[model samples]
Target: MLDIMAIISDGIGGGLKSVLNIAIIVFPLMIIMEIAKDLNILDKISDFCKPLTKWMGVSKESAFPLTIGLVFGLAYGAGIIIQSAKEGNLDKRSLILVSIFLVCCHAVIEDTLIFVAVGANGFFLLTIRLLTALVLTILISKKLPSLDKEK
Candidate 1:
């Protein structure tokens, strides 16, 4: 009985710790994103990413969220993506493309470092992920019917 109670307690404690850690990271990122939006930093980022987004057939508004997802992982990026969608910055097609791309390649730096620590080839891993994401997003974007046409 005592052992079971300890196990339950440990599980709950670990879950709370994980949640707290994520909250710590996500909250600050959300605030910084808001400040960046107010400063028009997002516009510059979108402009810089214009070529890539254009190639992906997504709106420029997707650039920031896609960049965030690739660098910081999806959990952190989802906040920005959701906010952009709510603001009407991303249409359905853009959202779908960004989600597809990030699903394949999110957290490139962190994941690559972790794999490298485990004796994996970091360059190969990063390259394959990036290439797969890019190709897949481009192909899927071409297939998807434009939401604008439905409206």
Candidate 2:
């Protein structure tokens, strides 16, 4: 028979561990994002990414969130994308493009690190993810207008 006290202890321990892990990752990332914003470095980075975004039919405004999703992860980047959408910065086409890309390959850095720790080929995985997302986003961008008309 299972011990009730032991199960309770394990549950609480798991919850605390999860909370700590999230805090460790999120707090430092938030600080870095804030510093980048304060120095206008994010704008510069987004400017450099404009050509790639344009190729995927994504807006310049969406580049910031896309870059964030690429580096940090979807959870952190999503807030920026949602706020921009609410502010009328991203049209349906741009939103669709960004969604396709991020869904395929968000959290490149963190995911690579985690995979590498487990002996996976992080660089190879990262490259594959990026290429796949790029190709798929390009295809989606090309097809989106026709799809929209059908809807």
Candidate 3:
């Protein structure tokens, strides 16, 4: 009976504990995203990607998604592509190429640092990941037909 009561209590309001938990998770994320937006950090990220995207055989417009992958990793970076794809910003050909790149790997900065901390062979892993992704991107481009017929 006591356990049931406590579970019910937690399910209902849970008072300050719930509020504190929400604040702890949300506040920092909101603040960081706000600062990032104001600082035009995404723009800087895109700028750094311009040359790489071209070399990848994708368009200049592709810099945005690739840069996102470089900083944030596959999920968030691929989310960008999906969102943009839905909004019709990206053609299917480029989307596939970017998707292939991200699917093989995205080098998250903090994760790489953690890899280094464990005394792993950092550059070896990084090199293999990048090479695999590059190869997959090209293979997908060669074999698959473009989905975006609009532009």
Candidate 4:
């Protein structure tokens, strides 16, 4: 069975390059994120984001994790959230809601660079992505249903 699987995989020749590229790109990014965490840069960024998060009905403590999620990807951001959750800083409902929003994902530099490299109106894509994130956040908060049931 394994031999058959390998043979099938071999049929997709050019597709194999994408797998290698994905691994190369992701591993370095993960390492960089770890370094940023160790350096307390993430903490500083979270502190900066607190006020905005507070205004949006999330705890100030949520700022950093959400920032990580936005600047990295859903996995990295959720790693932060999971830590916070383990420490009892975030409740179940808030984490769940935040995950929904954060899964939309962002990359601080790479995404824009890709657009510029490809000549796809980089600024336009960036503007739309940013606005969409902000608008969706506000809209979701407004549309949020009460998770708590009154006795």
Top lDDT: which candidate number? 1
**Model 1 regions more than 4 Å off:** 1-48
Score every model by TM-score: 0.69, 0.70, 0.64, 0.65
Better of 2 and 4 by TM-score: 2
lDDT of 2 by residue, 47-139 (tens): 777888988977678888888787668886788788888998977778778977998889786677556655689789989998999999998
Task: Summarize candidate 3's per-residue lDDT along 1-151 as a digit string, tens digits.
Answer: 8999988888776666656655664566557766876898979978987766765667677788887886667888888898988988877788878877877778455455456545667788787777787777776666766555544
Local accuracy of candidate 1 as per-residue lDDT tens digits, 9-121: 99999889766765665677667767876898756765676777898999877888987787668997788889998998989999989998998888776677656654689
- lDDT (0 to 1) per candidate: 0.82, 0.80, 0.73, 0.71
Residue 75 deviation, candidate 2, in Å? Answer: 1.4
The residue-level lDDT of candidate 3 at 46 comes to 87
Off by over 4 Å in 4: 1-39, 148-151
Pick the winner on lDDT between candidates 2 and 4: 2
Number of colliding residue pairs in each model: 0, 0, 0, 0
RMSD of 3: 7.6
Winner of 1 and 3 under lDDT: 1
lDDT string for model 4 (70-147, tens) is 777677788989999999898665676677667654674466555564456877887887667666766776777555
Q: After superposition, how far is residue 85 of candidate 4 from its true place, in Å?
A: 2.0
- What clash pairs does model 1 have? none
Clashing pairs in 4: none
What would the TM-score be for candidate 1 when compared with the true structure?
Answer: 0.69
TM-score of 4: 0.65
